[model samples]
Target: MLWLKERGIASVAESVLNSEELDKTVAHLLVAARNDGYAQGYAECSHHVVNALKVDWDTSKSATHGVNTEVALAAAKMQFNNLQLPVMDLIDVALHSEDHVAQLKEIFPDRQEDEDEDLA
Candidate 1:
């Protein structure tokens, strides 16, 4: 996301980017929010929380192709069901899915980035 990217955390591999890093990134945003500075940013509290879930890398591997997005999306769907979002809320699910994919894309923009960043 443009907003999250601005935080300089956008470069971190989304896979293996656990909730800790995400939470730290969010903590900074929360401070900005309390100061009313994050209002102009793209991510809101709910979006950040959902993004955190959608981007979870709780497994033992790094970015895997269709796997990450698919699983994350399916999980988000189940979460939406629990949240009781209406059928018209398809957009929300799709948006979160996009967020998941974007996170993946940001993960491996180039294969060499890992070795370069010492993430491998």
Candidate 2:
């Protein structure tokens, strides 16, 4: 956000970065993806929620009654790590996505042949 403002891209950044609708849509989509057996989709959504709660813990200055940041973050991370899977169908779908593979390629162009085979 600061980078965007520095670059004079505030309008563009605001339009793209607005999180209210994204949050609602993502929450809905997480369940949908889990039901549909899209592993990464579900995991990504679940991670988002976990991370958000952690952030809330860290940032809630007035919420003295709430759990402290360290404990909250630790719990959130543990829960994220231990979340039960949806169904096998969703797990199968979530484990593989061409888009994700492509992203991996972009990030690690010299990635191994075995990596390609696994994604294939």
Candidate 3:
């Protein structure tokens, strides 16, 4: 993704998005979210969470579509415990959404405004 590429997290984001295992994807995102500093990692992982689940990785969509609810719930809990603030909202929307990509867009918002400001 453009955003991930911009942040130098595109490789990990690609891996996270490409992975078929829900638990593994969530685990990878958590590690990235924790390890790469809050803002950068969270942005990258969260964006890919939406993209991965929305795209569902493979043709059938079953791979990501049927992600274990327990894993998602646990991931949400851990994120809230660890990050706090607006990230909790982002996590909640992502885990609960019927359409994760759209929900994430609404909740997390794009950095376009910030990017524009930077250019200015």
lDDT of 2 at 84: 44
lDDT for each residue of candidate 3 in 1-120, tens digit (9 for 90 to 100):
354345324433443455455455467667654543444444556568779788533323432333344454566556545643444455566758787555555544556766898899
- Identify the runs in model 2 with alpha carbons over 4 angstroms from their true place: 1-7, 38-120
Total clashes, candidate 3?
0
Once model 2 is optimally superposed onto the true structure by TM-score, how far is the C-alpha of residue 29 displaced, in angstroms? 1.2
- Tell me the spans in candidate 1 whose CA falls farther than 4 Å from its real position: 1-18, 37-120
Candidate 2 TM-score to native? 0.22
Using lDDT, rank the candidates from best to worst: 3, 2, 1
C-alpha lDDT of all candidate models, in order: 0.43, 0.44, 0.51
Estimate, for each residue in 1-120, the C-alpha lDDT of model 2 and write its tens digit.
232234324423443345354445555555544444443444456568778776532323533323334444445445545544333233235336555434333332332554788899
Worst 10 residues of 3 by lDDT: 57-66
Candidates arranged by TM-score, highest first: 3, 2, 1
TM-score, one value per model: 0.17, 0.22, 0.24
